[model samples]
Target: MLLTLDLNDQRPLHEQVAGAIRRAIAEGSYAPGDRLPPARDLADALGINANTVLRALRELRDEGVLEFRRGRGVSVASLVEGRLAIVLRLRELLEEAGRYGYSREDLIEMLKELP
Candidate 1:
């Protein structure tokens, strides 16, 4: 799997790494049940610390984008497509909300008001 980091991005390194992995998943570079490179390998490829990559991997696993297998390392989740679609759409919605000067809390409130 290919992962790219944006030096210009102001987010924390772990978040950037997580976002890169997320993009790769959403772009179909990694399919359901595809095993990812080991954390050491991913760190070498991205020129980041191994711990940083592990942190990102843990976050992705928690988000259900990836799963941990005892002998298989990490693999993309089988049901990721639907989750990715919603995540991508929510990202776009947040970007649109930002353009309109809407706070994240405002979006949360809107969600709360939804039936």
Candidate 2:
């Protein structure tokens, strides 16, 4: 899979990395048991610090979207339940944004400005 980080983006690199991985999982690009690349390797591939990659991995682990074992490396977790919950949360957020008079374009622009 191709992972990218935009140096020009206002959001931190770690958040972007985590978002990429999360989107991959949500879109079925990664399965529950799929293994993720090592932190150092992914860092090299993305031209970022290894610590940044690790931080992203840790965020996913904390969110129950990834599992990290001592020797097994990181892998996508069995997040079927979490997946549904996240979908529901996103829907709710979209509805909330609409209620606040935020158009879809406005939401997209706001997300683009996140940091």
Candidate 3:
């Protein structure tokens, strides 16, 4: 998986990383049980601190999008539950956008502008 970070983005680096991974999971790029790059390796590739990547991964884990095993490292969570988790997250985002007076179109447009 390729994670690109934008330094100018108002979102924090950890959020960006987690968002990219979440998008990848939603798009079926990384299927259930697919192993993700190690935090250190991903950090090096993105030219950021390993802690940032770990923070992102931990967030995903908390959200049920990814799972980290003692010896197996991180992998996409179960397909059945992962999609459900993603859908719920999307719903939360939409509600948040609504609170900010952003329409569905506005949210889609913003997503389209992301790398």
Identify the candidate with maximal lDDT.
1
RMSD of 2: 7.6
Q: What is the lDDT of residue 113 in candidate 3?
A: 100
* Candidate 2 weakest lDDT stretch, 10 residues: 79-88
Please give the lDDT score for candidate 3. 0.86
lDDT of each: 0.90, 0.83, 0.86
In candidate 1, stretches whose alpha carbon ends up further than 4 angstroms from where it belongs are: none
Regarding TM-score, does 2 or 3 come out ahead?
Answer: 3
Tens-digit lDDT string for candidate 1 (38-107): 9999999989899999999999889888999998899999999999779867877987998899988999
Q: For residues 23-112, what per-residue lDDT tens digits would candidate 3 score against the true structure?
A: 787777888889998999999999999999999999889877788899999998885364656665887799799889999899999999
Question: How many residue pairs collide in each prediction?
Answer: 0, 0, 0
TM-score of each: 0.88, 0.72, 0.74
Poorest stretch of ten by lDDT in candidate 3: 79-88
User: Which residue ranges in model 3 land beyond 4 Å of their true spot?
Assistant: 80-115
Question: What is the Å distance of residue 22 in model 3 from its true position?
Answer: 0.6
- For candidate 3, the TM-score is 0.74
Which candidate would rank higher by lDDT, 2 or 3? 3
Please tell me which predicted candidate would have the highest TM-score against the true structure.
1
lDDT of 2 by residue, 1-115 (tens): 6788777978789988987887777777888889998999989999999999999999878878899988999998876557745754775688799889988789889989999
